[model samples]
Target: MSTEPVLPRVRPEIAALPPYRQGRAASADGFKLSSNENPFEPLPGVVEAVRDEVALNRYPDATAGQLRAALAVRYGVTADDVLVGAGSVSLIAAFLQAAAGPGDEVVYAWRSFEAYPSLTLVAGATSVQVPNRPDGRHDLPAMAAAVTDRTRCIVLCTPNNPTGPIITRAEFEEFLAAVPADVLVILDEAYAEFVTDPEAVDGLGQRVFASHPNVVVLRTFSKAYGLAALRIGYAIGDARVLDAARATLIPLSVTAQAEHAALASLARDAEVRIRVAELVERRDRLVAGLRDAGWDVPDSQSNFVWLPTTDPAVATAFEDAGLMVRPFPDGVRISVGEATSIAPLIDVAKSTILR
Candidate 1:
């Protein structure tokens, strides 16, 4: 038999890893709270900008220069400090690629961003998961202790995914103090906009701390800016760290239309900020209502709440009620949407939990 050369098998780390399973796009009825997407449409200007940005004949700008400039202005930093990519997920993969190597350990909290371990493993790093405390927040001390001579990076997801808890500025400063300076710590702030803590440390500001030279702050236009479909995000860190991170990106990663939409969102950021305030109100209401029904719903600064569940049956109950939520092993993460969108969730909670 004539042999076409067999491609060498996949990398061991990647070959053994399980895939990232995302939430269902279609459900029987009602709203889907699974993905934590902004349940609102893009603002008119952003929508119009995206519509007009069709350029199939040309390649997108590899570095996303225009969007990075706009993000810099919006975040009060120089453009050199900013790096834009296809989505925060893409940036996460690049950061892992830049920071880690085979047999190197990358630490992050369990039940945080679901993608963390997947990307960490795919980049040839060993995943070190720090368990969440009783309140569903990262155990900072434990995470810091997980670092060793072989540790390469750490991901701190504030307003953490699934569990909507933010590490206070004081807590983060302490966490930074505990972590080894050589281990790159990525602060994933994908839901930073929905957060309203008066003393909350913007992840970008933390990247500026000389003591935490390894800190990289990650944020996305998906949640609060209402631009999930456009898939643009930015990371802020030391210029050298950013340089290394950029090297990991494939050619033309961020789309041209996404860049235009991101720029427009930055231009209309004040309006988006106002929208964030409104969503915060809705989040508060959802937490209040759920807690009143005798369920232990964590105080959520993000656009979602975590309900402590003793059984998976309770998770299925939510799905049966024409509502979709992210069911983790220990609990369900229910996203707060538009004021009206949250009504059905409240109704289901009242019917099932209260009565």
Candidate 2:
């Protein structure tokens, strides 16, 4: 008999799927600009609220009622219209599961959020990705045209990851009018709070939930609120649609600590806005410095800047200089981090351009 052991059956698609690649961690001496994390420390109130949820013996609220109520009030939606998940990523997965299955198709912009493709695949749905425009923004018209009868959903990411360009409000409204009212449209606004561009689409301010029952707006506490470790995010949409997503959620994945932290963060919105403004200024300075050094940096409205280059050598150059940056196949994304990291980042960009 052969010595090799037989393996159990597995879904071929799942087996072939590449694992999600996270930003590389930095060494003690290096600045971690790879992940788009807020550099500021957590607000004191948020920390205290998390600490207060120390009753480990009991399970957390499966529905996350208090947080949902708070978010509903802020958005002017009913509590039933809001759904909280472990993170925005989890909410994305839930939405996918609720709307898609085998033989269904999901459309989204290419070179957008890295997780979009994987989430679609996991739903046993086919992904129809429309390429980004030359400027790294979504070609809304092309995406709108790609939809077919089999298409179940569409994802739009603003201030797109790894390539920082936003979709304008007018463009979004026009695209929405073209898309089928029966299909779901998810606006992934993970970096919404950092946006300063006056014309950029504001999903929350638009009251899309009220106007378009088919649309869902996803927001997270990770980036702007400095709560990545807590893994909390929420969505606002039609109550029936959210109910479908809630049915697919992993029970109690939203922990008490995460919910408390989010509530506390919301309580100090003014303080959070101040911190976001500081980061915005820092991002502008960094972008200006890179442009002055002859690099083609995109206008970043998020807390990160995009360097359009496919060369791995460029990324290695930044890493070697004590700056950990995220490198995609077509570009690199460096987050606005500590004030000290700015000078070194600009230096690396200048050297890379010279090469």
Q: Which residue ranges in model 2 land beyond 4 Å of their true spot?
A: none
Count clashing pairs, candidate 1.
0
**lDDT of the candidates, in the order given:** 0.82, 0.92
Residue-level lDDT of model 2, residues 1-355, one tens digit each, is 9999999988999999999988888899889999899989898688878888647788999999999999999988899999999999999999999999999999999988999999999999999999998888999999999999999999999888768889899998999999999999999999988898899999999887688899999999999999999899999999999999999999999999999999999999889989999999999999999999998888888889988888999999999998999998899899999999999999989999998
Global local distance difference test of model 1? 0.82
TM per model?
A: 0.93, 0.98
In candidate 1, stretches whose alpha carbon ends up further than 4 angstroms from where it belongs are: 1-8, 26-29, 205-211
The sequence of per-residue lDDT tens digits that candidate 1 reaches over residues 1-355 is 9689877898776778788887755354567888888877887688788778858788989888887787777667778888998788899999899989888999999988888888987898888998999888889888888889998998888888888888888888888788778778888898888877777767775544345668888899999988887788889877778888899987797889889988888788678988888888888988988887777776677988998876777667778876778888888888876576677777777766743
Return the TM-score for candidate 2, rounded to 2 decimals. Answer: 0.98
